[model samples]
Target: MKPKRLYYWLMLAVGISGIGGLTYWDFYQVRIAAVTRNQRWVKSVSELLHSEQASMARWIEKFSIESATFRDIANSRRDVAALILIDNRNRQAQRWVRPGLRLEPLDPRVSVLQLRALETQKTTMGPVLIIQAKPYFTVARPLGKNRALIVFLDAARAWGLLREEASLWHIRASIYDFEKNPMFSSFDPVIPAGALAQTLDRARSKETSGIVRLPRRLSWKWLITFHFDPASDWIFLITQHTTWAYAPVIFFVICMAGILLIARIPFMALVGTRREETAQALAQFAGRVDSYIRGRDAMLQDPPSGIKELFPIAATARWLIPQWKRAEAFPRDLALERKLLSLLVESLPEGILFFNAQGGVQLSNELGRVFLSLEQEGREARMVSGVQVPRGFLEPYLEPVFTGAQPNLGKEVDVAWADGKHLYRLWVERVEAEQDKTGGFIVVVRDITFRKQWDYVQEQVLSGITHDLRGPLSAVLGYLDLMKRQLGDGAAAKVLEYLRMAREAGVRLSQMVTDILDVVRFEQGKIDLVIEVIPVVDVFQRIKNTFGVIAEQKKVNLKLAVLGDSNMTASGDRKLLDRVLDNLVGNAVKFTPPEGSITVTVRSENGRVLFDVVDTGRGIPREAQSRIFDKFQQVRPGDRSAGYGLGLAVAKFIIEAHKGEIRVESEVGIGSRFAFWIPIRPPDHRAAGKSDALVNMDPNEVVFPPPAA
Candidate 1:
C-alpha cells in the first residue's frame, strides 16, 4: 500500500478500537456500577428497618414493666390498666393518654400491688390496647404469650425517610399495605397498588428483597421492589419504579457511548487522515525548494487583483511558459522552411506540393497531377508512391508526402510521362505541426491555359470599348458642329429648335461619360455617401416627373401612387437615391411599348420606407438577370445607342452605400417591378434636406376651364 493509505488505515483502526473500548466500558462497567449502587441503597433501607424494630421492642417491654400492678401476669396487666384508666373514661383521650399509648379495653382478671410493697406473682398477660385501623403498619406486642400490645405506625413515612437518605444513589421508595395499598411514597407514585399486587404477593411469599417488576394502574408497568421485615409476619416494603431509577442512566450512558463510537470516532479518523495528508503535501512541496521560491517570488512580484483575472494567468504561466520556449525553435525553423518552399514554388513553372502532419495530401496546384500523368489515371495507376497508397497500380511518376517520425522535406523530383509531352517539378516541404496533431502545406499549380487565353478576350473587349466610345463621341462631335454652324445661321424659330436638338445629343454623350466615371469610382470605393432623410412621396414625385416626359415622348402613360402618411421618410443620400430612381424609372419608360402604362409607388413597410417602380415593359430574360448589375453589361441586344450599362450598377452601389437594398422582379411577358427599401429613421446627428413633394391628386380635384379658340 501507499504510505498515505497505510497511515489512514492505521489511524482509522486506532480510532475505532478506542471508541469500541469506551462503549464496552460504559455498557458493562458504568451500567453495572449504577445498578450496584441502587442495590446497596435498598439494602441500607432494610438495615434501618431492622434497627428500628429492635428499638421499638425494647421500649415496649420497659413501659409494660413500669406500669405494672400485678396480681397475675395477664389479669394484673388488664386490672391495673382498668384501675388506672377505666375511671377516666369520661375524659378526652388526648388530655389523659400519653404520646404513644392509648387505653381502651383491658381484661379484669387479677389484683394489683405496688412494686415496692408486693411480692411478684406471674401469670399470662392480657392483650395490648386495641388501636384504630389505618393504611399502614401497626406494631402490636402481647403483654403475655397469648395476649398482644399494638402500636399504630405509618410505614410510608419510614419509607419516605429511607428514600431521603438514599437520594444520592437515585433510589426511590414507596410503602404498601397488606392489601397492596399505597400509604406513603417519596415521589408521586406513577402506578397504583392494584397493578403491583401480584408482584407484591410473590415478593411477600418468597421473602425476597430485590428488583421486582410490576405494571402501574395509571401509566407504567415495571417497578423494582425491596422488602424488609420489622416484625414477625409483617413486612416493610420499599418499591421503586425501575424506569426512573436505572433505565434512564443506563440509556444515557449507552447513547453517549454509541455516539462516540459511531460519530466521533469516524470524525476523528477523518480529521487525522486529512492532517497527515496536509503534512505530507507540505513536505512534498518543500522538496521542490527552488520551484517554491520561484512561485513565491512570482506571486509577490505581481499579486493578482482578483481570482477572475489572475487564475487563468497563473495556470497559463505554469504550463505554457516552458512550452513557449520549446515551441519557439520549431516555429522559427518551420517559418523559414515555408518561406524557402514558397520561393521554390514561385521559381518553378510547374506547381509544388505539401501535406499535413498526418502525411495526407492537403494542397495541390495545377501541374501536380499533369506532371505525373495521373489526372485521368485509374485508382490502380495513381497509387504509385509508398505513401498511404490506396489500392492501385503504379503510375509513371507520382510521389507521396514523406513525413518521417520527425518532420522532414524531400528533394525535388521531375515527373515526365508519355513521351515527354507532359512535365512537372514536384517539391515537398515540411511544416510544424499543431499540438492538436494537425499540420498544413501549400501547393501551387501552373497551367499554361492562362497564357493561351489572355490575348483572345483582351483584344475583343478593347476593340468593343473603342467602337462603343467612338460612336457616341462621333455623334457628339457632329451635334457640336451643327450647333456651331447654326450659331451663324440664326434662322429664327426653326434654327433655334435645331440648335436645341444638337445640344440635347451632346448632353446624351456627357451623360454616358458621367455614368462610366460613377461606375469606376463605385467599384474603387471612392464614392462618398451624403446620407439624409428623404420623404417617400418626394422620391415618387421625382420619378414621375423625370420619367413622365420620357414616357410621353415614347407615348407611354406614367402614373404615380403615393401611399402611407406624408411624414413617412427614408434615410439615404438624396442625390444618389434620385439617380437610382431616375435609372429605374427611365428604364421602365424606355423599355415599355408605346401606350403601355408605368406606375411609381411609395409606401412604408416593416420599419422601413419602400419605393417601387412598375412598368408594363418587355422584362429581362432569366439568363441576363445574373449579369444585369455588372458594369458595362447591357440587356441582350437592346437599343444600344441610348446608353451603356453603368446606370443600374451605379444605382446598386449607391443603395448599398446607404445601407439599403434593391432588387428587381420580372416576368418577361408580364413586365417588371423594381423595388428598394431604406430605414425610416434618420440619424440624430445628421440634418435632413427637403424633398420637393408630389401628390397624385384625386380626379375630382382637377378642374379645367374651356380651352380658348
Candidate 2:
C-alpha cells in the first residue's frame, strides 16, 4: 500500500480504538456505581425491616394478654396486617385485627407457625403466605411456655413502600419466595418465571447480592441486581433496563465518531494540497517533453520542485532533454531523404502508391490520389485517396505477395472508373523489408487513353486505304487473265508465261488487300454475325473440302478427326466459322513441306466446341509467338510470297467477337498447333463491347498443351 493510504487507515484505527476504550471504561464505572447504590439500598431496607420486627416482638411482650393493647399496637403499624395469640395446643386463642384487614378464620397456618416458633425457641419469620388471594408474611415470637404471638405483615403495604424507594433510584423491585413464585412487585410488567427461578437458585448458591440478565421478546433485556434473604427464603431483585444502562456508552460513541469526522478535514486538506503541487510539477514536465518531441525549443534549466520523493523523477527528465536533442540528429537526415524521395515520386507522370502488408495505404502521390478517386482534403488525403481501389483492386493482388506465395510481383493490371470515362494501367511491384518477407508494394500507374485513341485512328486509315485498292487490283487481275486466254498458244511461250506471272501477282495483291479490309472491319466491331447452331462434323468436313485440293497439289496429307461427341455443335455465324477454319488451314498448307501432314480436329470441351489445326512444319520462334496474331505481323517477314500477315490476326478477332479464345503452341524444330474454342451459346454481341470484354477475359483460360517430349 502507498504510504499516504496506510497512514490514513492507521489513524482511523487508532481513533476508533481510543473511542471504544473510553466508552467501555465510562460505562463500566457507571454500572459499578449503579450496582453499589442498589446494594446499599437493599442493606438499609433489610436493617429497617429487622428493627421493625424487633419492635413488634417487644410490643407483643409488653401487651401480653391485653386484647385492647394488642389491637392498638397492630393499628399503630400499618405494616402489620394482624396479631394472633395461639396456645400450645395448636389453636388461635386471640386475634387482634386492623380495621381494614379481612382475616380469614385461623386454621392450620397458625399451628404451623407455632410449631416452627417452638422448635427454634426464638423469633421466626414465615414464608410469604397467601390469604384470600393477597400475600402476607408472619412474624412469630414465643410469649411463654405453651403460647406464641404471630404478627402478619401485609405484603401489599410493604410493596408500596418498596416501590417508592425503587422510584427514587430508577429501579424496579420484585420479591420471590423460595418456590420461585413472585409474591410482591414494584411494577406490573410480567417477569419471566423460569429465568427468575434460575437467578434465585444461582443467588442462593453464591453471594447474597449480584447481577443477572433477563431477556424478553422484541430484543428487550433487563439488568437485575438481586439480594437473597435466607431468613425469609425470599429474593429481592432490583432491575434496570439494558437500554438505559448502556445510554452513556451510546452517547460517548456518537460523540467520538463526530470528533473523528471533524478531525479528518484538515489532514485531508493538507494531503490534497501536497498532491496538487506534485501533479502540477509533473504536468509541467510532460509539457516540456511534448514540446521537445514536436521540434520546438523547451527550457529545462529549472531545479526539481514538489515533494522529496518526486524530486528524482523531475531531475531525470531534466537530464534527458539534452540527450534527446542529440538523438534527433540522425533522424533529421532520414527525414530529408524521405522528403526528397517523395518529391521525386510526385514529379513523375505515373501514379505511385505505397501499401503496408495488411493492405492499408501508407503513402501516395498526387496522381495516385486522382487515379484512386480519393478525397483531396481530409484525414485520408495523406495516403491513397480512393475508397474503392485499395479494397477492390490492390488488396487482391497484394495478399499473395505478402504471404510469400508469389515470387514474381511486378505485373500490369487495368483499372477502370465506374463510368468508364478513364482507364489506368497499374504496374505493381512488391517490395520486401527482409529476405523472403514482404513489407508492402509500390504501385505505378499510367494513363493510356491517348495511346489507345491513336491506335484506333491508324487502323481506320489502313482500312480506308485497303478498301480503296481492292477494286482496282481485282480489275487489273481480271484483264490480265483475259488477255492471256485470248492469246491461246499463238503467242510466244515467254510472253505467255510473263502474263501468267503478272496475273498471279495481281491476284495475290488483291487477296492481301481483302485480308487487310477484314482485319480492319473486325477491329472496328462492324462485322455483323449470323449466329446459329452448326454441327461440329459439318464444320470439320467443310474445312477439309476447302483445303483438300491445295493440300494434294502441295503433296501434303490433310485429314480431319472428330473427338468426343461428334454430333456436338457450336453456336456462331457459319460463314465466319468457315472463314476461321480456311485461314488456319491455308496457313498450315503454306508452311508444311511435301510429305508433311496436316490434321484438323473438332471436340467438345467445357461447354464449348474446340477446334485444332495441327501441321508438321518449320515452327515459329518463341519470341515471335506473342505478336503472331497482331495485324501485319509475320513470323517469316522476309518472304514476300508469304502474303500479308493478317491471316492469324483476322482469325483472332473473329473468334474473340464470338466470345471465344485462340492460342498457338509451337516449338522451333517441331510442328505448330493452333487452337480456338467457341461457346455453344454465344454471348449477346451488344453487351460484349470489344474493349471491355477483352479486358475482363482471364488469360489463364487460354491454355495450350505442352510439347510432346
lDDT of each: 0.52, 0.72
Please give the lDDT score at residue 12 for candidate 2: 79
Best by TM-score: 2
TM-score for candidate 1, please give it: 0.30
Q: Residues 1-709, candidate 1, lDDT per residue (tens digit)?
A: 6665566567656766665666566545644454456556656765676565555445445665436532232342221222222112252221122234443452222112111112222221221222343222323333333233333333444455666785765555665544454544566554446646655776568654544444344225344555634332233344443354444446656665665566556567776987786666545434443363445434312322322344454555657745665687788889899788766665666665555543355444445534433444454422222344322211111223232221211222323545553322222333446673435543434443444245236435544675578677777777677766767665687867867787777677667766765654554456766667777777777676666677788899888776758767778778988888888887887789997988777777656666778888888875566456656778775768536777888887776555555666666987877776666665322212111110111212212211111
Q: Give candidates' CA RMSD values in order.
A: 25.6, 18.6
Q: Please give each candidate's TM-score.
A: 0.30, 0.39
lDDT of 2: 0.72
Winning model by lDDT: 2
In angstroms, give how far residue 659 of model 2 lies from its true place: 1.1
> Candidate 2 clashing pairs?
374-385, 374-386
